[model samples]
Target chain A: MPESSLRGALTEAVLYILLALYTPLHGYGIMQKVDELSHGRVNLGAGTLYGAINTLLDKGWIIPLAGEMDSRRKEYVISETGKEIVAMELIRLQELLDNGRVVTGGTV
Target chain B: MKHIVHKAYWDYEKEEQWLNEMSHKGLALEDYSWCRYVFRDAPAGKYIYRIELLDKTGSHYESQKYLKFLEETGIECVAAYMRWAFLRKEASLGPFDLYSDIDSKINYYSKVINFWNIFAAMELVIGTMNVLIGLVNGGRYGGLGFNFFLGLPLIGLGVALVKLGDPLRAKIKRLQQERAVQE
Candidate 1:
């Protein structure tokens, strides 16, 4: 039931975060990646990032790195589920970009 | 130079805005205690202040972990009061918003409602109890007029809390409906 909700649906912040976590990324690193990924267009706030991280973790889309426990600085990686979401999101984005190019006269 | 500003616990948005306004006037928050805020002279437009209310109670470890996380993002914790944490960052680092998305914003609003609803309920409960006891005892304690007057303020405050919850709950519902449609 919950899996159905993950179909083609993710917030912009969550999409960027999943895209950024192709490799292990720390909290701060995720923020930087989002900023870099968006080209400084979408500023991810600390609180919003924290909330998104928690939500993804709850959804089993991301997992905490082992041996980092006992310390507040934890790292995360996109799980298999998270990767699937990323793939879905990428296809969705590709279609959007394709439409833009087609409508905007061959420019994306 | 220093300025002391007093604000209630429920006025966090106003407090954040006021702190930002002060920073714009070349005054950065040095410290604050209770309702009084202490500010010192600093370069104008150099800092951005943010506040987050801790939702969990009696969890020092959780709060510390949150603070540590904020530090990693270049936001430094300057002060903490009860469940509220005050954080600051150099504006030169660019703009930062605490809750950007609707769902996250709803989470924040729910936390606030949890805190204030409990407070307001307690006030109303005590106020009613005092009036009832006073009425039963009659002149043995304070006069009826005295008890009524004393309870009046508490009742008024409880009404204020109820008013506060109405807008917040409506916002939560609105966000939930919008999210439902999108999903």
Candidate 2:
């Protein structure tokens, strides 16, 4: 599995998906988690979610759990590399937040 | 009770909407093959329908797996024809969509556009080749050959298919610009 570059800002969907996979989840579970995490603001359609999951799997950011293939639905969890990407994304997001605060002169 | 309707659809979105409208009229889509749709009686607005062009044909292993995944998500594969699958979810499951974000929508459109463009290009090439062959053979026989007549219609069909992709290409351009600014 190839690792995608971690330099750019992750899309909102990718970030939420990585966050969602902190715990093992199947395709539907991931969708539900993303919806809940965004407070229903982000509703992932089945096709889109499927595409994202496959991309994540290909990028080695997520891996299917062992012994879950007996059933039709397979479970996936975030990989070590995925966690590292998430950490970088957090730092990038924090920088953006800090810059926003400085520019707007609003303290939070 | 089974009700069958023969309809031709050039646009999948329009087909989806028409299927949904049928569902609202108590006709739930049961199966689809070519221009034929089989419907069963159900309550009005009982189901919401969606159509997608799979990366492979319906019988292919990958498409079957994808359909299985969709079924696990409470979306049912109502029918499969060629590379197209018709899916429906219970209307009560809130709103159902196959693409939630702009990026995925653009990706879907790209797939569609690519399919049409390739198909149309093949038609154009074959049609042009047939026409040229017919013309050369006609000059030898002192009249237009049958191939010439056949090729004329094929070329027209190819041109129409290309024209059909125009709006989708425009839609992709607009979405790309939107993504550039928003993302």
Which candidate should be chosen as best, given lDDT against the real structure? 2
List the candidate 1 regions with Cα displacement exceeding 4 Å: A1-8, A70-72, A91-108, B1-10, B57-59, B139-146, B165-183
Q: Score the docking of each candidate (DockQ).
A: 0.55, 0.78
Instruction: Give the per-residue lDDT digits (tens) of candidate 2, residues B55-155.
Output: 99999999999999898889999888989999999989878998888899999999998888888998899999889989999999979888898899889
Instruction: Give me the chain B TM-score of candidate 2.
Output: 0.95
Interface RMSD of 1: 2.2
Question: Candidate 2, after superposition: displacement of residue B175 in Å?
Answer: 0.4
Which 10-residue span in candidate 1 chain B carries the lowest summed lDDT?
B139-148
Cα lDDT of all candidates, in order? 0.82, 0.91
lDDT of 1 at B154: 92
Model 1, position B61: C-alpha lDDT score: 81
Candidate with top DockQ is 2
